[model samples]
Target: MNTTTTEAVPLWRRAAAELLGAGLLVTVVVGSGIAASRLSPGDVGLQLLENSIATALGLTVLILIFQPVSGAHLNPVVTLADRALGARHGGGEIAVYAGAQIVGGIGGALLANLMFAVPAALSVTDRAAPGQVLGEVVATAGLILTIFALARTGRAALVAPAVGAYIGAAYWFTSSTSFANPAVTIGRIFTDTFAGIAPTSALWFLAAQVVGAVVGVGLVFLLFPNRKAQP
Candidate 1:
């Protein structure tokens, strides 16, 4: 237990922290995205661009602000892999973090749906098609890997817009449209709102993301090997 993040918390407690933070993030993101979509009316591109920029800025701010408290992994997969093989190991923390992320995402989506007055879509079943899924894998892989590289190297100071920029760009370029955060993906399952996904396809996308995350970590090790941990 090097830090509070290392050994002070139980799994359920950590999950609670992660969930609370994640829920707040998703609320802001999905809420903003919907509001933009409404304001744009006909121009989805401009609207999405606006959405992306805002989201990036927001994400950066949130990560920087919360890093001290939670390390702001925000994404469960990041927390899990990082704890197991990378930085800031903590017992029972991974499960808690992952659980919280999923629940938080759901809370965010629900908020978005309420704000938007979304029609009876019942499900945001819009999973990435085959082509899109490939894009998601690449984008998510890049995102997780980049995040780990920075955090482990003590370059977390640069994280202001790291997840935000990655997420915004991934939204623009990827076919699966970058389900960059596993928690966000799960949270979105609750509603067919702006960022929602159908339950059936959620698992597949999640599976791909896990794979992408692994690949990303491996690449990081090869390209930017870690320094020996200090005494």
Candidate 2:
């Protein structure tokens, strides 16, 4: 009998990957939003198109870059789901990953704001409307579903592009422009740009994301209960 076991990567390295990857992800998101807003000042649709393209491309590149080291789980819910789905890492790792992501997101927002020559400011744009909240739940659920379903079906290689593409589409389809990430949500509050979300509305967005995560997990189990863990 022959068996192969994967060596555990050092915790510090994984944490670093999480932090850097998450930060860069936010940078792409917020930076593109700012650029789009300015570059197409009067045309909302054109701004959205530009932002979505940049985000999709950036996310794909980021995931491809970091997936080997950290599994490229940039989102907290993705980390949680990996643990729940029997990833070798533990709860402690999850906490660290989430913390790193949150910190990175904030740092990324600040960096983007600085790059744009905009003062680092808190968002005043309120997005707590009912339609936006509902859109968040749907967007997050679809995102989670996209990730795990691919994992379950042995299509891990496709995750980067698929997830990126899904998000790009969700930006257009969802009322809230698919702010499906908690860390990203928190980070966006620091920017007063097009990508920013008001601090007052952050809690509701967070709640909706959590609800979406739960729904996504439930769907995964229902659809792939017997699936084996993938690399």
Candidate 3:
């Protein structure tokens, strides 16, 4: 489904695209969250709605912008899943992409804080709970399932919108508000805003995401076993 071959574009260039894409994705998420909080004030539901809409739209655009270069894997889990599902990336490549994504995500959060005139600080909001952890597992697993199902079925063209829609819906369906991305989750730790998560909470989220990825990959293999189904 990823038409961009490694030979067609240098790995370094692809990594750069990944960094930029991940950065912008976080920017959209954190920035919109800040705006939503300020605009909605006491109305938590309205704030969430605004944030979710902005994130969904922003993600769709970013994917379309960078998919041809790096498959627009703004999330580390997605990148790792891509590799596990046979995307032709070597171990070094995966490391580079994941590292770039994490760094870029942090940068994005910092930028959002600066833009909102808020000092960059560690989040105090703790979300470490059994229900939230289970929610993360569900959110991440569904995310992986959505992407791979489309990719494996040769419907890669629909991935951007489909992923955006899935995440938007998951925001309401999941208790953790669908922080399914490790990079984004880590980035959020830097901003003490409405969307930020504390360090301890992020650890739980990252672990759950890893578990969810494994489950999603296993499901993918089960549902689409034939190598010929993979583009």
Candidate closest to the true structure, highest lDDT = 3
RMSD of each: 3.2, 3.5, 1.6
Prediction 1 global C-alpha lDDT: 0.70
TM-score for all predictions? 0.86, 0.95, 0.96
Q: List, residue by residue over 1-231, the lDDT tens digit for candidate 2.
A: 000112267778878888999898999999999999988999999999999999999999998888877888888988777666656656687799899999999999999999999887799999999999999999998988898888877778888999999999999999999989998999999999999999989999999999998888888888877665455
Ranking by lDDT: 3, 2, 1
Clashes per candidate (backbone, < 3 Å) = 10, 0, 0
| TM-score of model 2 vs. true structure | 0.95
Ten-residue stretch with the least lDDT total in model 3: 1-10
Q: What is the lDDT of residue 231 in candidate 1?
A: 25
Q: Model 3, range 1-231, lDDT digits (tens) per residue?
A: 133344477889988988898888889999999999999899999999999999999999999999888878888888888888887777898899899899989999999999999996899999999999999999999999898887887778898999999999999999999989999999999999988999999999999999999998899899976444435
The TM-score-based order of candidates, best leading, equals 3, 2, 1
Q: What is the RMSD, in Å, between candidate 2 and the native fold over all Cα?
A: 3.5
Query: Which residue pairs clash within candidate 3?
Result: none
